[model samples]
Target chain A: MLSRKAQYAFRALTLLVDKYDQGPVLISDIATKKKIPIKFLENILLGLRKADILESKKGKGGGYYIKDHPSKTTVAAIIRIVDGPIALLPCVSLNFYEKCKNCDQRNCGLHEIMESVRDATLGVLENRTLEDLRTGKETLAKKG
Target chain B: MLSRKAQYAFRALTLLVDKYDQGPVLISDIATKKKIPIKFLENILLGLRKADILESKKGKGGGYYIKDHPSKTTVAAIIRIVDGPIALLPCVSLNFYEKCKNCDQRNCGLHEIMESVRDATLGVLENRTLEDLRTGKETLAKKG
Candidate 1:
């Protein structure tokens, strides 16, 4: 399962992407729109800003907006920023690789299957940008 | 990530599949072999048994063995049994589906991407079995 934090990140991103041309939106508005707990959302937003996914502006109209263009940002990027590796096995993870204790990757039965899973997930996630998500299409990757 | 319990389940299953032809093995043997805490493993095994994945035999010269043939049991099945749904989003899960609060699934940006992720993961996991893990070979599913 995606952690609550990651789910919140997706929700927040969706709203921000939709309102990208409307200037910064208040944190309270985003929290309320997405129905996320305000305190929790504050932390999530901070992380997103630190990751360079969001830009926070200060002053009277202060709020947040997408720092990265929606076309360039993938859901996988958001997930990794908030939830850590997408792989089930550390050994199979691209960004969070770790040798499994007592594991022989070459001879391990789960390795091949787990690798396929990782590759398959990457195939989907790496291609799904915020723009595509915002439009909610049937996936362009399928046709290509 | 797979939970500690689910990882332990995989480790336990792999070991048992390796020793399948040799007859039932002791829970202690499995725990010691996999370095899983005995008490923790005891609970895990009970769940697997209840799910009909393992057949337990009591008394001397009797222990536990795979109830279902390893070749026929997918890792996906084990994870679902030990860890619940494998889908990243609750709304996309086949067994654990729930409407995302405030979500319009048809227009939700996260829905399509999450569904693709779930489909990709299931595509890989549903095809893998313990026998494939025991000997550690390229899956025939890959060729087909």
Candidate 2:
């Protein structure tokens, strides 16, 4: 499952997607609608901007907007920016990984099994884009 | 996607499973091997006992043991006991649900799509068990 930060980021991004083509949206407006704290949201948006998931403007009438089209964005992208890893275990993680502390054996059985779950999890999360999530489109095509 | 508690519980249960029919394991043994904090694991074990996933004895040479066969105990059952809902969104939830805060329509497109993802996710996690994890079997079954 996603973390609170990831959840809030998705909610914020969805709000942005709902209004992206409509000029910039104030962080306050998004926070108010999303029931997230404005200060905390500002940091979240800042993180998103740093990751290039969003672009921000300052001063009056200035706010944040998606740098990429919603359809081009994936929940995996947002999750990576916010939570750092899609894989549950460090052994299977792409962006963040280290040898499992408990794994001394090169052919550790636990790692092998976790890798499968990891691949399945990443397959689902990475393939589904923001557009898929927004439109409720079944993009993966494969049945579980 | 599992919590520290769930992850610890799963590891502990798997350890017990690995030592199946060897008699009960000491809490200290599980905690040390699984790298879980002793105090926190105690609480988790208590909760697992209440859920009937495990049974405990109070005397010396007694700690914890799986109540049922490892294959019979699905990861979902353990997770549900530790984490409230498997789905990321309440609208996507199977057992626990509340209306989406911003959406008035149950037929909202977002709800429909997330539900599918949730179902797919559940299908995968719920079917996996400690036995599968222990033997590292069915690794290819999850290939996308």
What are the models' TM-scores? 0.94, 0.80
Docking class of 2: acceptable
Best by TM-score: 1
Query: Candidate 2 has which clashing residue pairs, if any?
Result: A1-B1
Off by over 4 Å in 2: A104-110, A133-144, B32-35, B105-110, B135-144
Clashing pairs in 1: A109-B133
- For candidate 2, lDDT tens digit of each residue in B18-58? 88778899999999988999999999999999989889988
Q: Give the winner by lDDT.
A: 1
lDDT of 1 at B58: 92
Off by over 4 Å in 1: A135-144, B136-144
Q: Candidate 1 on A1-144: residue-level lDDT in tens? A: 999888888888888888887899899999998899999999999998998889999899999999867988887888899999999889999999999986778777777778888999999989888887574454445412
DockQ for each candidate? 0.66, 0.29
Question: iRMS of each prediction in angstroms?
Answer: 2.3, 4.4
> What are the Cα lDDT values of the candidates?
0.86, 0.73
The candidates score, on chain A by TM-score, as follows 0.91, 0.88
